[model samples]
Target: MDTRIRRGRRALVNWLERLHRLAPAKSVVWVPAGTFALILVLWIGTISRIQAEGREARQAAAGATSQVASSFAAHIDKTVHDADVAVRWIKYEYERSPSTFRLDTYKEKGLISAGTALQVTIVGPDGEVLQTTTPEAQPVNVSDRRHFLAHKSSPDIGLYISRPVLGRVSHHWTLQFTRRLNNPDGSFAGVVVVSEDPDFLTTGFNNLEALGVGGMLVVMSDNGYLLSRLASGEHASPVGPPASAYREMVDAKGEGFTDPVDRVPRIVTYRHSTQYPVAVLAGISEKVALAGYRHARDLYILMAGLLTVVLLAAAAIITATMTRLVAARARMQHLAETDALTGLPNRYLLTEILRRRIGRERPLDRLALLFVDLDNFKRINDALGHQTGDELLQNVARRLVRVAGNKSFVARVGGDEFVLVVEGMDVAVAARDMARSIIDTFELAFGLRGNSYVMRVSIGVAVYTAESETEYDLLRQADLAMYAAKEEGRSANASRYHTFAPDLAVRGMRDIERQQELQYAIQNNEFFLEYQPIVSLDTGDTLGVEALVRWRHPEKGIVLPGEFIPFAESTGFIIPIGELILEAACAQFSEWMESDPRPLYLSVNVSAAQLVHGDLIGVIRQCLERHSIDPRRLKLEITETAILKDAALIARRLKELRLLGVRVVLDDFGTGYSSLAHLTNLMVDGVKIDRSFTRGVPGDRTALAMFQSIVSLTHDLGLSLVVEGVETEQQVNWLRRFGHIEVQGFYFCRPVAPGSLQAGRAA
Candidate 1:
């Protein structure tokens, strides 16, 4: 026997065993048969009647849906034909007698007509009312409407219907139809607009009969504004633009078929006017459309109840008809096939569907399997407890059913993860915007146990096309897409079934290796120091040495700070690197001070990261005390641009460092954010003139003048200046001639080890 048959037999046996346990053998066997047979007969009759009613209900809903659709088409046909007639008549009269059919003449001739509470107005291209049949001469602008623009820009115009809008001129509802007016030379002279009240079209919406018990009829704009509804209660109060519920549907454009306006299942349909861009929507309640299905469902429930009674009676009759051993075996089989929760189809049933879908050779239409994972679901389970999380999942499942409607199938694959299979839709519809809408749906602040928490969903969409030849391939792509979404910061990301790019994979590997290398560098004391001597131009004496950092790599030897410093900064490892440089510089300075106590300062270049970090000052204080070095022997060199940011704060911080006897020098003085105004705003010991100006001064006249001016300004501001990159006697002389500027370059000596420096003046 098949598994389902065995399970059914086991379920019957289990019912018999329970009955035997409750009552004596004679009563259990005799009494239940009599009771169950009568109940079964009545239930069978009830189900037959219910099914007939269901079939009738379904027929009625289909007829009603068809009726509403037909009425809308009729309304569009009538409105466009009437508008075409009115606009063309005005054009004909104007062409016949341009002078006689002028504004006042047309009104006197009764050329314009009025209907009910609606009026018609004909305006020229310049916005002047040429003729009017309205109670008041309403000033109107036709330039903004597409109908008017179509007439204004083109000559081929009879009539054009514009999108519905709140008429600015009338302060009442109106639809505009424009007719083009042309000069004898075929140039656009003006346009004639016929304005009609909206009731001319809304009458169709007002007349739609009820589709079912819970049915409703509504007419809305392409932009989702509710123009009118057929429901009796003050439709106007809530009858305006669509709210959050219809937002996604409207954005999707025409024929946005979805479900449930405030949990009342609905069918939404839209049609765009062939004559114009205007859109009309018709919404029918799902309760009404599926009212027939409810009757079928009610009949099924009755059948189940009747079957339960019949089984009880049969079991009583067969109290010992089947052997005790067979009854026990059957009961065990039934338990294995059923799910404990939800009582819906199990994994086994789902596999059967997948197998059948894949076996067919027919061209499968576009199908998408979206694997949705709840964000922060684990956090909710951990914080609020699992019971609340379980309830939240159930609610999410219900919402998915509402959103997916009958167009898609949804299943709970595992904890907090749901699978949605939407068929016969374009794959692009499952992309980012739709994913965002799904997330927004869950973000509506879920209420649980008197506490509200926010929830979000990340969907990984896998579309089955000709590329996906197998079911496994489709499932794998969706799983990979889910992982991609999580890795890329987890709101939603979609991936297709393709190999990961080599370049991106290589980059990820390199990052991991680099992190490990950085960790090793930090652990081992591999960092060392190098000092470059700064020589005085006027006196030709060694002034100071700027401390530079070098790394003694395990494999590669002597790595420059420039090579590794950027990596360190990007990886946020610069804090430790800066500390190493500061400590080493201060200790080296202390040793040099003992040999030459005559206050020759040591300048250390500081990166922007080192200066901006909050703990830098404290690190500096700790290093100074540890080295037992005089603070005055240290001069901090920073760029002009670095100081320009929050100058007031930097100045205050620099003042404190200066008070501790440390000198501050501005490096790259001319390269960035350099201005005389900054010199006054910031308190610095000296400025290191950038090398560009010095390197070009001899060859370029502009460079020479700028260099000369900078030198003069440094003295005027009462600040000392260092001219860097001086390589020859001539360059040194040119810098000296500028007066009081100190120079440091190859003219004196190249940067050397601290011990290589000779303090004596040049002969």
Candidate 2:
């Protein structure tokens, strides 16, 4: 037997030596074996880490939920205690003077406050509602109500809290705190109750972040009756009784369990109120609690799996695999830096380049950042389809790059905005030349979808002055300059490019300060209305008044419309400002109609922003209805520039207003490019010729002729005409020559405070 065993061992050793000699076989077996071993080790470690992390996450969640539950319990206990005190007070008052007791009188005397209870009621022993705090006390019987029966049957019951139920008197969901009221003989006389809205208990705690998604805050009685539940900041109805697992978790003070109803894992904690037979439960969704852990676990597992696959495959074609990985990384970097739509460097890459250039030991002597913004891009985009808009943006980018030349870098920063960096060889001059060239190129229409579309851009230039200027400051200055360019280009012949100046920075800061002040003004009612009467040339009597907004700045004394009107329009504060003016004007007009018994109308100037973005029609309707004023008494005066901006939208809105019986008119009529079109398309009831046209009126022959022609044309079109800025009697005389034309100017009355204006006359 020993000789046979020795022969077997010699045979095995020879076989192993032969196997080791085969290099390809060894490579095949060892590579997969090593991969398998690495994979097993990684998976084991990954699983262990994940399990430990999950446990830690659960423990943290349980601790947090327990804290929240404790807080909620304390809050509820205090709330119930206050309600019970109110109940006891009412019980004492009733037991002392049942006949003379009145909830209204107590409320009037400030003995009882509405904050503690939604309603207070007194129920006789027969369960008949005797008195209530509700304004309109209705007869109610609660013979079978749990709150009343619980208090009446047990005199020892100090304070019984009832589940949420519809109140017999208030007809709203409320929780009741009741106590038995006895006579002098110690017999059950009646029950005094303080009913509270369940929402009041949870409304004070608004930190919903503590309760993650699908989590809930619940207040339940000892018998497991849900009194109030809040989920996701909303009141929710009971889903049913708690499952056995949930009960067990509550009993343990805090634990993790799988909810049977939703089948979602949760970490739950509860606290029993020491003063009341109730508990507050705070449950956090385990999924949300361990979201970060799960994410890390998934990433690690995926990485490990990929590593294993790569290792196994890399043995063959190791060089090729490395080459492909390098190429893929390079491609990814490119993708990250490049804008997907315009194929230009994105904002990220632009920021990086700017920072690098600005942060160098020797900064570029002359670097310029040109911020280009497409004018009225949103309007055009909305007019044309998004597809066409995208195409247009792409074409614009190509043109910009072409105009910028190879020396400059052009990046599409965001939505219809591009940033061009010019350096070397007089960058400021180069920036100006590039901006002009780009503008000229855009002047020629671009063919999109077989249609020609002309687009314009506003360019702002900011040249680097010092190394102290940061990237953020540079960008902000450039952006401010761009807005300045846009504002300048509002006219037809103004320049579309502006250079950053010290004043521009000052203006930007002032604008921010003013915006905050304006917000405060709106909140504190610092704005008031001034009325200027519009007089009829024929009757020589005040016909209507134009509502003008005036800001009573606490510090500046008084800020005129011109000082902040344009800023308000730009910042979209004009919407709220306009609403206030409209409502005030309508209310004033309504009062005038009641006192004077004369037909009068009110005119409120509507900004272009208000016309374009505000709910003009709805505001008008609400004001008219609220003040009980006739819609015809309210006339909206929209500027011709506003109509020219979005003629179709403005016309539709005006038509809707007219249909509601409100009159519409055009202000600053002849200043816009499309005055005739506005008159015809807008269906306006009247036109107020701009103050500029009236400035040279009655004296300048040219102005008089133009005014005559406008009056004739307006009369021909059967539209009312109001000649504005009639400062002199001669102008009014000339206007009157046109046959009873309406006139408004300082000659009639300057704008005055609402109190200064009389019922039937100007101030």
Candidate 3:
């Protein structure tokens, strides 16, 4: 999963790089385009919503107007029915007894109300007014009225309603409701007319609050003649031509249209009376009906516009920042792939180049990789300052580049190692010749700080085979050949360069296998410890023990330290193996202290790799704390080589250990250079004599003298001394001459398991 994620990220970076290379400005243009698209979508959605709300508002308005129209129609029908009943009573009384019938009599009895009509009159068959309810009882001719003419012409006309006209007797505009007066012979006699004011019908049914501003309530005849109309809280006289569509319309329905009277867009509904020849129209203006919808729609558009502006600004800022970041990342990637000091391709880039070259579609006839390593570069670096070493390495890089020319690629892969890829070579001999040329060129001394120092480099040449080797395999092979060259250079008749042979491949494979085995051994807990007693020569009593790690290989039975310790050290497996040893030794010593009252200290060897790379001090502190052992009871044994790597750092670590009350001793004392200086400067608690010096003690006088001198030096310095490689009683007896010297060898006890060691063993 991690590999897949890394590949995906790399692919994305590559794509971006290509885009930037093609058109940098065009890459950010999409931000504005995307913003515009988003705004368009917002506007489309908002407008659609506004339109939908407007439709709903219109529907609601239409429904309200329709309801108002229905109510108005019902009221008008009732009023007309009541008026017809009064007219029939008047007609019946007149027809029954012309002598007794009188308009004043009906008015006195309260049967004829002024609310229903303006005046009531009886017209004789000659079309002249005979009796009237109005104060003007003057004689008048009413034969020309449509109501009177219709009733006089036909006896079948029950009740006739006339359009608004000027009353002959009252001299006012009124709608006449008339019934025929018939004699006992079934012939028309005269007309009974009820004069009603047209404005009364509209005023009686007006609902200004429900209709709103610019609303209308109108009653019209079936012939399209307007009877009564009220608009915007005011009575209106019918002036325009009758609406022909209203006359043709039979069903009660609602619609939106422009009103002819006011020229206003309105939602209008029409309801026709079932019994009467009249219809009611209720209308509401569109502007008033959709006022709220318009407000909300405007608000939505404003908010959307503001949001679009903010989003576009943010997108612009983000695009600018991303553009700058992309440019910075390209520069950083170049710097990362190149070495800082040498200004050459680093290991990471070297691997990629090698992979690409090896994975090409067309294979080269002969390809070679040269692994170059400086001889004793670390010694030169340590003897002189690192700055000088760096300058020297740079000079070497220039020289190697010169030797390789332009055809080959050279890269610095490590502090003192460089790799060169030679392609297009015709034969294997050419590759070897190139390696020889590199070695021969480096034979000259490098000039630094006005000093001419001869620097030798070992070169290893590995030729590529088709379909058989990978980039890693080539590197490994070249490295192995380089080590072989260094080994050969140790002899008198030595060659400074070597080509990779099949034997070197075998050796490399063995090394790889050994490293794997060591790793497996550490992981599986296959390594165990055996403690060797450090006996006090004065009292012949066990004072302390040194812990030695041995690997119990599953296949090789019991593997001794001599076989795998150096391998483990070189491969960095020693750190974990050393940790295991320290933990086991501390635990075992704690157990011993618990069972027995002996105040014996435990000494665990510290490897060079552990001192330099691993967190030695923290590991020791944890071990001491975990086992609940006194710091003084735990001694760490370090070789002079470990201190030589970084003396100041090691000294400081040793001082911290002393502060913890832990003792630090130099193991194999006499073998390293400046031993006495280390003893004084490093503040060591004790020093152990190398086994070589003790092997010849009492037999070889030179060895005895050296051993005695070391002992006297420790005693004089107020430092403890332990002699290693004590074999027979003769050596132990000889070591007794050196008073207060401790011996650890087979003479006292061989290294054994925790169960085998006796508590009070004395030599």
TM-score of each: 0.37, 0.55, 0.55
Candidate of highest lDDT: 3
Point out where model 3 deviates above 4 Å.
1-337, 347-365, 374-393, 424-430, 440-456, 486-496
Better of 2 and 3 by lDDT: 3
Residues 294-346, candidate 3: write the lDDT tens digits.
89888988998898888888888977886887678767866887677777667
Candidate 1 global CA lDDT score:
0.63
Error of 2 at 626 (Å): 1.5
TM-score of 1: 0.37
Count of clashes, each model: 1, 0, 0
Whole-model Cα lDDT per candidate?
Answer: 0.63, 0.79, 0.80
lDDT string for model 1 (165-224, tens) is: 565556566666667888777777677667765545655445455444444444454444
Per-residue lDDT value at 275 in model 1: 55
Q: Candidate 1: where are CA atoms >4 Å away?
A: 1-501, 641-652, 673-677
Native-structure RMSD, model 1: 46.1
